[model samples]
Structures are given as structure tokens and as C-alpha cells.
Target: MAELAHIIPASTNGPRATEGADLTESERADPTNILVLCPTCHTMIDKGYSQYPAGELRRWKERSRRARAVAFGTPQFTSRAEARAAVEPLLGANRTVFQLYGPLDDVFDDTRADQWGRHVVDTVIPNNRTLLQLLQSNRDLLTDGEKATVDIFAIHMKQLEERHLEGNWTPGSMRFPDAMNVILKGDG
Candidate 1:
């Protein structure tokens, strides 16, 4: 199920805080884009959140190849724990997009963002396209809302697939921009 504000962007800085600061198109969008994800569906959309049209996913692959220069592991969320710490306690009455096998609390690990990242990718990639096909072929069988969800998920899955094809993988890292902003005790 979609967790409210769970798949959020990587920043908390309001616009004025970063005024005139250099930012990539991606970084600026990080904090705002984080979406609530279900345990089963989180795996697929780990790389990025913006689900683009088909033509873009294909084009991005070509661009990514050129941008990739050295051997680098996938980026792990440096701020995973901090983000979770901040978000979890406040999720007292957030919405869920889908069903879970157990308590939501049981499905998460606040300290380890890497595992969380993987789970997101795994949930969205498999059968994403296949599901689209099923929906298209059986449109008559679906309610209007079901059909809409199918359409949205299909876009997300396709975007993730493109990122995958373009080698948009990351390994564990201590200081990624998208990581949680942990304020260690006694530091401030």
C-alpha cells in the first residue's frame, strides 16, 4: 500500500534556505517526490520516483550510458534512519495504498536504508509491464478506479525499468544527497 509521504524527496530545506544555491534538476525535486510505498511494491521504484512516458525511458538509457564513466556501486540512502525516525512516529494516521501481510511496523528497518531501497525496487519491477498488458486486454473487467491505478503503476514501472536499463544502480554509501539528514546527539 502507498504510505503517505513515505517516498518523499531528500530535502527538508524550504525554498529560501537554498536560495541561489546550485541544484540539479533531480536534487531540487527530491524532498517533494518521496511517495508512500507498500512493502511489496517498493522494490521496483527505488532508483527514482518520476514515472516518465515511454519515449523518455528509452532516451534516458542512451544518455545514462554516456554519463557513466567509472565502476560505481549503487547508492545507499545515507539518511535512511533519520528519515524514518522523523516519519514513522508521525504516521499515526497516514493512508495506505495497498494491503500488507503484517503490521507495517514489522516490515520496516529504520536504520538500514539499503535494504529498504532494494525492497522498493523489487516491488515495482516484476510483472509491472505484464500487469499493464493484463489491464489493457481486460479493460472491461476492471472498475474505473482499478483501471486508473493500473495505468499509474504501469507508468511508474516503465520509468523504473528505464532506470534499470540505464544502469541507474547505487551501492551503499555514507553521504548520498538523497540520504536521510541525521542529527546526531551532541553534534549541534
Candidate 2:
């Protein structure tokens, strides 16, 4: 079942809870401050299994709204800077993900190798795919130089993906960091 979850918890009894005082009950119940989640997700957030702060929840809401607007033929005409404001946070996160990459020798156990391989196959590849989709959809909004840089980055990502599938930890593993460096430094 679907449930409406609060971005900020309702208990006005902690130091941080004081921030909610600025909002009246109606404002606190604003649709923008709520998310429709499945029962499991609702319970996870409410029980602190997933600690989503107010700011992060708000960003998710804004991204969802923008995505819906775009899908519905009502895309917002935001400036490059404004568009970057929303996207840079996501691209910045890509840099951090790369920090987890290391040499293949670290995975000595077969189980650990499987786990690491799954992470590359499942998480990293899909995440990059989403980033690529976002870039492709907004290609017209980007500068020519930005487009060229992302195009090259996409090619690099594709090559890395092939290496990931092979599950070898030699040169392909070494090249992963370099590709990420180019992406982190390159225009998105």
C-alpha cells in the first residue's frame, strides 16, 4: 500500500525539531513536503533504517517534479547555471563512487569477488546509464564543448563497462580510476 511520509518528523521535541516551528500545521502538511512511498519504504524512513534529512528529501522532491514536468511537455526553461545547480550534486557524487575502486588483488575470496563483480554489474553500470540518459535528454541545453566532453566520457564509460563484465582486475581495473578522473574533471 502507498503511504504519505513526512520529510521532517512531526515530533517537535528535539533541538533540530525546532526548525518545524516556522511552519503551521497546514504548511507542515504541504504536499511538497510529503512523498508517496510504499509501506516498506515508509516504515524504513519512519524507523530510521534510511536516514533522509529534510534537505535531501526536498532535493528528491524537486528532481521528481522537474522530471515529471519534462515528461509532460512542460519542461522548465532553466539557465545553464540553474540546470547545473540540480545536476552538479549528482555528478559530484560520481566522484565519490570512484573512490571505492581499488586493485582486483584486494578480492581474494571467490565470494568477495562475486560481490564486487555484482556491485560493478548492478550498481555502477546502472548508475552511469542513468547519468548518460540525463545528459542525452538535456543535450540541447548544454554548450558544444560540454556536449563533446560528455560524449567522450560516455565512450570511456562504455569501454570500462566492457572491462567490468570480463571481471579481470588487471589493466582494466587500473584504467577505471583514470576514466573517473577525466569524468570528474571534465564538463558534464
Q: Which candidate's lDDT is highest?
A: 2
Best TM-score among the predictions, by candidate number: 2
Every candidate's lDDT: 0.38, 0.61
After superposition, which runs of candidate 2 have C-alpha atoms over 4 Å from their true positions?
1-77, 103-116, 166-188
Measured by TM-score, how close is model 1 to the native structure? 0.26
TM-score of 2: 0.43
Backbone clashes, each candidate = 30, 0
Q: Model 2 over residues 79-134: C-alpha lDDT tens digits? A: 55555554555555554554454225445667655555666676667767766766
How close is every model to the real structure, measured as TM-score?
0.26, 0.43
RMSD of each: 24.5, 12.6
Q: Relative to the unseen true structure, what is the Cα RMSD of model 1? A: 24.5
Q: On a 0 to 100 scale, what is the lDDT of residue 103 in model 1?
A: 22
lDDT of 1 by residue, 90-178 (tens): 22111121122112445564534444344434553443443344345445544555456556655555555655455554443121111
